[model samples]
Target chain A: MSEKTLTYEQINDELLGMLERPHPSYFLLLLGFLLALGLFVLSLAIQIDVGIGYSGISHPIGWGVYITNFVFWIGIGHAGTLISAVFYLTRAPWRTAIYRGAEAMTVFAVMTAGLFPLLHTGRPWLAYWLIPYPNQRMLWVNFKSPLVWDVFAVSTYLTVSVLFFMIGLIPDIAIMRDDAILKGKKLKALIFTPLSFFWRGTNHQWLHYMRAYLIYAAIATPLVFSVHSIVSWDFAMATLPGWHTTIFAPYFVAGAIFSGLAMVMTVLIPMRVVFGLEKYITDHVVQSVCRVILFTSIIVGYAYFSEFFIGWYSGDVFERSIFYFRPFGAMKEWTLLGDQSIGFPQVAFFLMVFCNVIAPIPLWRWKIRNNIMAVWIICGLINVGMWFERFNIVGSSLQRDFLPSAWGSYWPTIIEFGITVGSFGFFFTLFTLFSKSLPAMAIMEMKESAHPPMRKETHG
Target chain B: MGKFSGVWASFEYLDETTEAIEKIRKQGKQPQVLSPCPRHEIDHALGEPQTRLPFISLIFGGLGCLTGYSFPAWTASDWVLPVSGKPIVAIPPFTIIGFELTILFTAIFTLAGMIGLIVIDTFRNPLPKGAKKYPRFQRDRFGVVVSCEPSQTKEFEELLKAHGAEEVHVENS
Candidate 1:
C-alpha cells in the first residue's frame, strides 16, 4: 500500500472539528469555578465575623482544615512538575502527552495553594511582614519558625513552578497562535509572543529550551518534595508527641504525591471522557498512572503503620498514651476525632489504605485496565482516600497531644468545607479553559518521540 | 564524517558531551546524540568542561542559607522578639528557606545557562510553510539530523531511515 499523505489542512480540519463542539466539561468547570469563588467569598466573610475563632480549630488544634487544605493543594501541585521536568530529564517516553497539563496544574495549584495561607491569616495585610527584606519597621522574618519556613518554601515553590511553566508554554503558545482555527486565538497567542522572547522554532532554540526544561524539572521536583515535607515538619518538629517523627518528611511527601496522583486521575478521567480524547489518552496511560497511585499508596500505608508501630515501641509515655487513646487504643479521654469515640480517623487511616493502596490492585489485571467502570470507581476512591489522609494527619494528630491542657478539637465549619470544595471547582475551571486554548498534548514532544518502524500512515 | 579523538559516547542526559569526544577516536565517523533536554551532559558536550555553577551558586545558596536562617533569627531575637523565646536562626530553622533559595537559584541558573549555552532562538521544525501541503510530521515522525561528510550523507541517511526515520533531508551548510 502507498503512503497516505495528510495535508496541514487535513490535520487542522481534524483538530478544528474536535474543538467545534462545545465541551460539556467546560460547562461543568464553569459552574464549579463560580461556586468555588462563591465559597471563597463566603468563607472569608465568615472568618471576618467569627474572628478566625469561629470554627472548630482552637488552641492545640490551631491548624485545622485551612492548613490541611494548604497542604492538600500543595500536594496537588506536585505531579505536574514531576510529569514535566523530572520525566523530561529522565527521557521517559510517556511524558509527552501529559506533561503540558501537569505543568499547568503545577502553576494553578501553587496559585490556589497560595490563597489558603493568605486566607488563614489573621491580618492578611501583615503577610508582607514575612518578606525577607528590611522594612520601614526593620522587621526580619522569623527564621526558627515553621510558619516562616512555610512562607519561604511555598513562595519559592510557587515562583519556580510559575517560571518553569511559563518557559515551557512558550513554544506551545506560538503553535496555537498560528492555527487559523484559534480565530482571535492567534491574537491571544501573539499577546504572549513577546513574553516568549522571539521563539522562532529553530533547532538551536529547541536544544536550549529542552535543556532548560529538563534542568528546571529536575531541580523543581526535589524542591516540591522538600517544601511539602517542611510543611509537614512544621508540626512534626513541634514536640507534639504524635507529630515528632523522622519519617514525616518522606511520609508526608508520599501522601502528597499519592493525593496528587489521585487528584490528577480524578481530573483526567473525566477530562478524557468529556473531551472525547479516548484516542489520545489511551487505557495504557491510565494503567501507568494507576501503577504510580499503587506505588505511592503503599508508601503511605507503610508510613501509617510505622507511625503506630514506632510510637508503641518507643516507650515514650506521651507518645504511647496519645497513640493509644486518640484513635487506636480507643481511650475516651483521648479519643477526639469523629463520630466514632474510638474515633473514625483511625478508620480513615484504613480507608486511606483502601482507596489509595488496596483498591488500585485490581488495575494490575489486564481485564480491569480496559474496564472504564472499574477505573472510575477506583478514581473516586482515590480522591476520597487522599482527602481522608489529610483529615487524619491534620485532625488526628491535633485531637490529643503533649498535654491535655493544650489539646483542642476541630471539624470543618460549613464555610471552610464549602471553600475546600470550591478549590476543586477552580482547579477544574482553570484546567478546562487551558485545555481549550492549548494543545491538550505536547505536540512537539509527541512528534519527536521516535519509535521503531517509522512510516507515514502508521499512526491511528 | 566528523572526526573524533578518544573514548567518546553520549547516551544519558547528564553525561557531559566531552565523553562523546573521547569516543571519536574509535570510529570512522564522529558521533553526536540529541538528548531530550539540556543537562550537565553539556559539560561533556563541551569537552570535559568544568563549569563553576556549583562553587559559585553554593556560595549563593550558603548566603541564602545565612539569610533564610538568620533573617528569621535576627527578627525574633533582636527585633520583634516573641513571648515564646523561640531560638533565633536555628539550623533546622532555615532548612526550607535554605532549600528554597538553593533550589530557586539552582533552577534560575540552570534555566539561564540553558538559554545562554544552547542559544535556542528560531525553531527548525514545525508544521512547515507548505504544511497546508504536508502533514506527516504531525501524526508521527521523528527526524534525527546526523552531521556527517558529503560522501557519507546517503549512507547515514539510509541507516537512520532503516532505524525508523521516515524521511531524511540533508543539506550542506
Candidate 2:
C-alpha cells in the first residue's frame, strides 16, 4: 500500500496481524532450530562430562571457537542497537519499520552471546562468581580484569536493550491487547494485558512515555558503543601480538556494526517476505541498510590494512611475525596430498578477507544492492566472513605466539562445531518465536510519522 | 456515584481534537487528551510542561556512577592485592564499570519513573467508566475527556459536538 492510502487502522491490522496464525514454514524453521538446540545441549552435556579439554582448545591456544563465537555473537547485536537507539535519536524515518525487528535481534543476540562465556568456563554453575558480591571468603571479583569489565558491559547492554525494546513495544502491545479483546481472543488478551501494563494511551502515559523513550534512546546510544568497546578491551588489553592494539576498539566496533547489519538483513529480508511487510520494509530501506553495510565494510578493510601496516611499521618482531604468519601459513613446510601445502590459519585469513572485504564491494552499485537475492547472499557471506574474522583474530594470534616452542595449532572438535551451530540455533529460535509473538514493526511510530486524519485545514 | 463526573468526547480528526482541548482550557477546565500517538499539536493545546522523568534518570545515573566507582575502589583498597604494579584502584578500568552502570541505572530509573507517574496519574485522574469501550482512541480517534457535573453533561456534550466531535458520552458516577 502507498503511504498516502495507508490508514492508522490498516497499519495496526497489518502489523498486528503478524502475531495471529503462523505459517507452516515458521514452525518448520522453529523445529529445525530446536534440533540444533538439542545438538547444542548434547554437546554441552558431553563437554561438561568429559571436561573442557574435549574441545580443540589446548596449550598455547586456550581461547578457541568459544571465544570467537562469543565475540561474533556479541558483535552481531550492535547493528540492532545502532538501528533502534542511534537511528531513533537521529530521527531517521526508515528506521521506524525496521527498528523493532532489529531491537528484538539485539536482545536475542545478546542473550545468545551471554551463553558462550558460561559454556567456555566449563563450570556454568559457578558462573555467579563473576559477580562482585561479598562472599563467605570476603573476596570480590577483580575490578581490573577486562573479563570482569565484559561481564558488566554485556549484562548492562542486555538489560538496557531489553528495556528500550519493551518501552517501544508497550504502545504496540496495548494495541494488540485491545485487538485481542475485540476479536475475543481471550488467551492473547490474557497474555498481553499485563504486558501492556494497562495502557490506555492517555495523554498522561504518552507524555512520560515519550520523554522516557527519548532518554532511553540517549542512554542506549552510548551504550551501543561502550558494550562493544569493552568487548574489544577483552582482546586489546591482552599482550598478544595481533590481539593487542589501540585500533581494536574502533576496528571491532566497525566490524561489529558490519556483521550486525548483515545479520539484520539476513533476518529481515526473509521476515518481510513471510509477513508481507514489503510496503513498510521498502526497497529504499533495504538500499539504505546496504549503503551502511558498504560504508562499514570499508572501515573494516582499512582496519585490516592498518593492522598489518602498524605491525610492520612498529618493528615489533612478534607482531610482524604473527601478521606474516597469518596470510602465509606458519606451517607451510608440512605437505599434504603429494605436494599440496596449506595451513588452517592461512585458509582462515584468506576466507576472512574474501568474506569481509571483497564480498561487500559489489554493494557500491545501486543495481547490485537493489537485488534482494544478491544482497541476501552477500549478507550470508558477511556473516560467515565476520565469524572467520573473529576466528582469525582469536585463533591465528594464539596459534603462533612469541615463543616458537609454545606455538601450536588449534582445531575445533565435533563438540565445538556442534556448540557453534547450536548458538546459531539458539539465536534464530528465539528470534523466530519473537517475530511470531510481538509486533515486528513499530505500529504506533508508523502512525505518528504518517499524516493524521484531519478534516479542517488549520495551518497554525 | 460521586460529586464529580466526566464528559468524554471522541474526535475523528486531530484538528478538531486539539481545537476542542484549546476550547475546554479556555472555559477554565482542564482537559485530558487521549491519542493513539503523541502529537506536538496536542501538547501545544494542552500546554502542560515537559515530563520530569529525565531529572529522575539523571539523579539515578549519578548514584549509579558513584556506586560503580566506589564499590570497586573500596574493594580493591580493602583487598590490597598488588598486580603488575598497577594502582591499588585503577581509575581507567573502573571508569568503564562506572560508565556502564550510569547508563544502566539511568535507563532502569527512567522506566520506573515513567511507570510511577503513569500509575499516579491513572489513580488521580482515572478514566471514565467504559472509556476504553471507544477503542478508536487507541487506534485512529482522539479523545478529550473533561471533568464536569451531571447537570453540565448536556452543555458539555453540546460544546463537544459543536467542535466536531464524532461521539460524546457523559458519566455521572
Candidate 3:
C-alpha cells in the first residue's frame, strides 16, 4: 500500500489537534471507564476489608480467578514491548503509526497486572515483603523462588517500559510545548518546557537521543521475552499436571504476543475511528498486524497440542488424568453447567480452543485480514479466548487433584467478578486519558518517513 | 549572558538548512542546527562527533548484570538459606534477575547519557543564554543559530537569508 503523503504542518495540525480539543466521545468513554474503575476500587476495598476469601477460592482450587487475571493482564502487556522495541530494532515502518498507543497499553496493563498479585496475596499492605530490601527482621526474600524472580521481573519491566515511553515522548513533548506557547496555554507550556529538557533538536542532542533510543529498544526486546517467561515459571515451577510443563515459557510468550496484538487492535481500531485517523492508520497496517496475530496463534496452538501430547506421552497417570478430565469430564450434579462447574469445566476449555486456536484461522484469508471489522471482531474474541486459556490452565488443574477427597470446584463471587470488570475499567481508564492528553501517534517518526517535497535536481 | 548574540534562521526544508549551516561554517562561525527531529544529513553537514551513550550503556549494563548475579550469590552463601531442595545459589532462576537488572541499568544509563548531553550542551545558562529559539524549529521547520559578537549579527542574518532561509530573527544577551 502506498503511504499517505502528509506535510509536516498537516501532521502537526491533525495529530496535535486531538490533544488540543478532545472529542466529546473521548470524555464520554473515559467517564464510562471511570465508573468501572470506581467499581474496581470498591470491590478491592471490600476484598481487603473482608478477606481474600471473598473471591470464592477454596480448598484445592486455592489459586483461582485472580491468578488467571494476573497472567492474562501480563500477557496483554507483551505486544507493546514487541511492537515498540522489537519492531523498531527490525525497522518495520508501520510501527511508527501505532507504537505509542501500544506502549501506553503496556504501561497500564503492567500496572493492572501488578495489582492482581497484591490482591491475590490477600494482604495488600505487606506486599513490600516481596522486595529484597534489608529489613530488621533478618529475613531476605527467597532468592531461589520464581515468585521472587517475578517481583524483580515485573518491577524492572515497569521501570524500563515507562522510561522508554518517556524517552520517546521527549521530542513530541517539545512540539507540544511549542503548540502550548502558540496557543497561549501557559499551564501546559509550563509543564512541557521542563519535561522537554529544552530540546532544540541540536545535532549533539540527536546523536545522544538516537543512541539512547536504540539501546532502550535493544534492552526492551529481551526484557519483554524474559518477563513473560518468568511469569510462566511462576506456574511451571509448581508440580500441578497442567502447570508443570517445560513448554510454558515459549507457550506463554507466544500467547502473550498473540493476545497483545489482539489488544493493540482492540485499542487502535476504535482510537483511529474516534480520532478520524484513517489516513494515517491505514488498512495496510491493520493487515500487517492481522498476519502477526495469525502467526502467533499458530505458535500458541502448537504449544497447546504439545502440552497434551507431552502429558499423555509422559505415562504419568496424574498428568494424563488432568489432561483428559480438563475438557471431557462430566459436570457433577451439584455443579452448574457454566464456568462455575466443579466437575471438569469443559466450556472454558473448548472456548479457549475455539477463540485462541480456531478464531484466528479466518485471518489466513487476505480479504478477511484486511477487513477492519472482521479483524476487530476476531481480535476481541481472541482476547476472551486468551483470558479463558489462562482460566482453563489455572482452574482445570487445580479443580481435580490426585485425591478425590482433595478435589474442589472454584468460582468467583460478586466481588471477584467486580474486580475483574474493574481491572478492564482500570486499564482503559488510563489508556483513554493517555490517548487524549499525549500524542497517540509518534509525530516525529511519521515526519521522518514522510515523503518530502520533490528536491531540486542540481546539474553539475 | 556574556555578550552572546546570534541570528536564528528558519528553513522549511532540510537542504536549505544544511546549505545555511555550511555557509555559516565557511564564514568560520559555528552554527547550532535545530529541527523537530534529528536529520542525519544535517549531522553529517555539521561534522558533529558521534555520542558515547552506547558505550556508557554497554558498560553499565554489563556491570549491572554482574552485580545482579553476584550480589545474590554472595548473599546466599553468607546466609545459607536454601529453599525447596535447590542449591544455595541457584544459577538458573537467578539468571532472570540478572537479565532484568541488566536491561534496567542499560535503560537508566541510556536516559542519563541523553539528559546529561542535553544539559551540558544546551541548558548551561540561567535564562536562555545560549542559542536563540525559532518557534518553527520545534515543529516542522529546521533552524540554525550563528552566535557571535553583537556586531556580527547583521552579517550572519544576511548570510542565512541568502541561503534561502524563510525567516531570520536575532537575539541579544
The TM-score of the first chain in every model comes to 0.88, 0.96, 0.95
**Of the candidates shown, which would achieve the greatest DockQ relative to the real structure?**
2
At residue B12, what lDDT does model 1 achieve? Answer: 19
Candidates 1 and 2 compared by DockQ, better number: 2
Residue by residue across A260-324, what tens digits does model 1's lDDT show?
A: 76677767777667656565566777777777777887888788789879988998988887666
Tell me the native contact fraction for each prediction.
Answer: 0.32, 0.86, 0.67
lDDT, candidate 2, A195-303, per-residue tens = 9998899888999999998888889889888888899989899999998999999999999999999999999999888777888988889999999999999999999
Residue range with the least summed lDDT across 10 consecutive positions in model 3 chain A? A333-342
TM-scores vs. true structure, each candidate: 0.76, 0.97, 0.94
On TM-score, the leading prediction is 2
> Per-residue error at A373 for model 3, in Å?
1.1
DockQ of each: 0.18, 0.84, 0.65
lDDT of 1 by residue, B1-173 (tens): 12321111112112222333333323354343333222333334434433333443455556665665555555666765545665544566566666777787766666666555444221212222222122222232222334555776666555544443334455553
Better of 1 and 2 by lDDT: 2
- Score candidate 3 by TM-score against the native: 0.94
Model 3 chain B scores worst on lDDT over the 10 consecutive residues at B124-133
